[model samples]
Target: MSFLSSNPRLTQNEGLAPAYNSQSEQPFAKPPVAIESYIQDLIEQRYQEQPEASVVCAWDGDFTYRQLNNLARSLVALLSAQGVAPEVFVPIYFEKSRWTVIAILGILHA
Candidate 1:
């Protein structure tokens, strides 16, 4: 999905930023699982916990967790329609940006 079409609330700056810090030590509710499983669960958990929270802050705009989840789901559907499957090498070549994050999530979910 195009950035503009997927997230209409995206605005210039507005002092948006991720609510959490990656470098900070965080506690988990449960013991750690495998990387793949953890990532999938984490994505869903974030969406559930705070759908409107900013997950990606790009030059164009900040993407909320809900928007990211929706965009990723849309990409997953597109990939499935194109016969994409597990272990398939889906090369996503985009400059470091929000779309890249969405693509990665799509590939993983697909």
Candidate 2:
């Protein structure tokens, strides 16, 4: 089957992500996760479920969920040490790369 047939949410939502379902074993299955849910929580869940899965593939390198989580956590610690407050906007300027992905996750998690 084509990707659309295998993952109907793409067609159903017109490119929006499918709701995360905790009870479903399949990664793509529909669940009741709110669209406004914290991005960190989603990443943590994905990290827990598939630590070795690739979360980023950039010109520099491919980074797995485990690496992404670890790097993001490190950034979080650094931000905390620097007294970065929660909900504060942390602007990131970079050409898209693996580090950019890590920065975004780090800022979201910080």
Tens-digit lDDT string for candidate 1 (2-108): 76577777554323455433212344635666575558679789899999999999886778999999999999999999999998889878788778888999899
All candidates: TM-score: 0.64, 0.65
Tens-digit lDDT string for candidate 2 (1-110) = 58678786652354444453332337555666668667788889999999999989988899999999999999999987887768787888979788998888888878
Please tell me which predicted candidate would have the highest TM-score against the true structure. 2
- Show the colliding residue pairs in model 1: none
- Lowest-lDDT window of 10 residues in candidate 2? 16-25
lDDT, model 1, position 56: 91
Question: Where does model 2 exceed 4 Å of error?
Answer: 1-36
